[model samples]
Structure formats: C-alpha cells, structure tokens
Target: MIRFHLKCDQDHAFESWFQSGEAYDKLAASGMVSCAMCGSTKISKSMMAPAVSTSTSVTPPKPSAAMLAELRKRVESASEYVGSKFVREARDMHDGLVPERPIYGEAKPHEAKKLLEDGIPVLPLPFMPSKKTN
Candidate 1:
C-alpha cells in the first residue's frame, strides 16, 4: 500500500493508503476520494515528505469490530433512512424547507461534494443504512 497526504478544496489535510499510485489516480479521477474533515470530493495530493517514526512515537488504536457494530446500531436506530433522496432531503432540512431530523441515505460523490460546497452539514456513516419499506 502507498500512503499519500491529500488536501481537499477546503484545505483540510489527511493521509490515506491506496493500493498503488495508479489506484489513487483512478479513485481521484472517479471522485471517490473525499476529505476526512468535510467529506468534500475535490481532493488533491499535498506536498509531503517521508516520515520516519522513532521508538517514542505513539500510534492510535483502531476501533474493534464490536465497537463499530454498536455505533452502527445506535445510528440506524436514531436516524430515518431516505435512500437515494439523501441529497434533496438533507438540503431541504438544512434550508429549513422541511423540519430538521436525523436522516441517513445514499448519495453520489458529486452530490455529496455539492452539498458540502453549499455549506450543508452532512456525514458519511460507517455502514450502509438499511432500506426501509412498508
């Protein structure tokens, strides 16, 4: 895996691991890469130098599967699933055209980027929302 330091149009910097340089290029071209802070899809590689970690360096622990599962459960229980209409629903809520409530749904990368650019707050949940049907 190769790690690249990337920044979004909003100038938030974060590092992500890709399978290879080509993998990063393809994903970026497809607008799949997003900012870790704002979820913006307009990302570019930032200038970075190789890091050399010493013995004194500390690493953060990864969350366990159990923890992630529990989080998914709580979020799913609290939010309404809006499916493919996520972008419109979220924008309506943000604009006060609809009553604001917790919601989870699907969005294309470009849709998400537009939402962020419009200053609407949204987040990508760790798990796909279960589709609700009558």
Candidate 2:
C-alpha cells in the first residue's frame, strides 16, 4: 500500500492510501477519490519529496524547537492524561459516569482492541511522552 498526500480545490489537505500509483490514478479518474473534509472531487496529488536518492550530501530537514514545543502544547491541551488508567478511564467515560472529554493514555494492544470492539472511539497517537519512573 502507498500513501499519497492529496489536496482538494477547497485547500483541504489529507492523506489516502492506494494500492499503487496506477490504482490511485484509476480511482481519481473514476471520481471515487474525494476529499474527506470538504467532500470535493477536484483533488490532486501534492508534490512529495523523493523517497530515495544516491546523493549523500542532502540532509533531512529537522523540526524546529518552537514547532516541537507547539506540538507538545497542542497535545497537552487537547487531551487529558490518564497515565496507566487509560482503559479504566475510557470505560468510565463510555459508561457515562464522567462527562465526555478528550483523553490520552497508555493501554495494551489487547485493551485497545477491546475498547474498539466495544464501539468506543480510540486512536493511537504517534508520539507519547515517556512516563517518568522515580
């Protein structure tokens, strides 16, 4: 599977997975590929950086410290930290004991699967701060 960064005429950006480049073209031509945010069909692939190169002089760009701090702040503000009690907290919220709120926590894969099976919305965050052990 290949992931493509796509943009719609409405300036909405999103990623889509396609089986192959040919498959992406086929779907786009058939009007099957639509923007998730705006539901616009006037979508096109955005320019992507080359995946591989023989040149060793090119250096990968790094995220600025300010950008990293901003990302951390966004995550911190957007979700409540439940630590190791993620599963229990999630279950509590699902049962309506606590008011619904965005939360983030660590859970085993099995726990996450069970939560999903129970129809609770959950997504794995790409980055999570390590729990300090003192």
lDDT at residue 127 of model 1 (Cα atoms) = 67
Q: How much lDDT does each candidate structure score?
A: 0.75, 0.71
Q: Compute the lDDT of residue 73 as modeled in candidate 2.
A: 61
Prediction 2 global C-alpha lDDT: 0.71
User: What is the overall TM-score of model 2 with all chains considered together?
Assistant: 0.49
Tens-digit per-residue lDDT, 1-134, candidate 2: 57788999999877766656765786577565666555677999998875665757887456567655555565565567888888998899879888767667788999987887776656565567444221
lDDT (Cα, tens digit) per residue for candidate 1, span 1-134 = 57899999998877777656776786677565666456677999999898788879788567568756765666666568888888999899768899877778899989987886776656566666666551
In model 1, which runs have C-alpha deviations exceeding 4 angstroms?
Answer: 1-61, 132-134
Task: Please identify model 2 stretches exceeding 4 Å from their true place.
Answer: 1-10, 16-71, 130-134
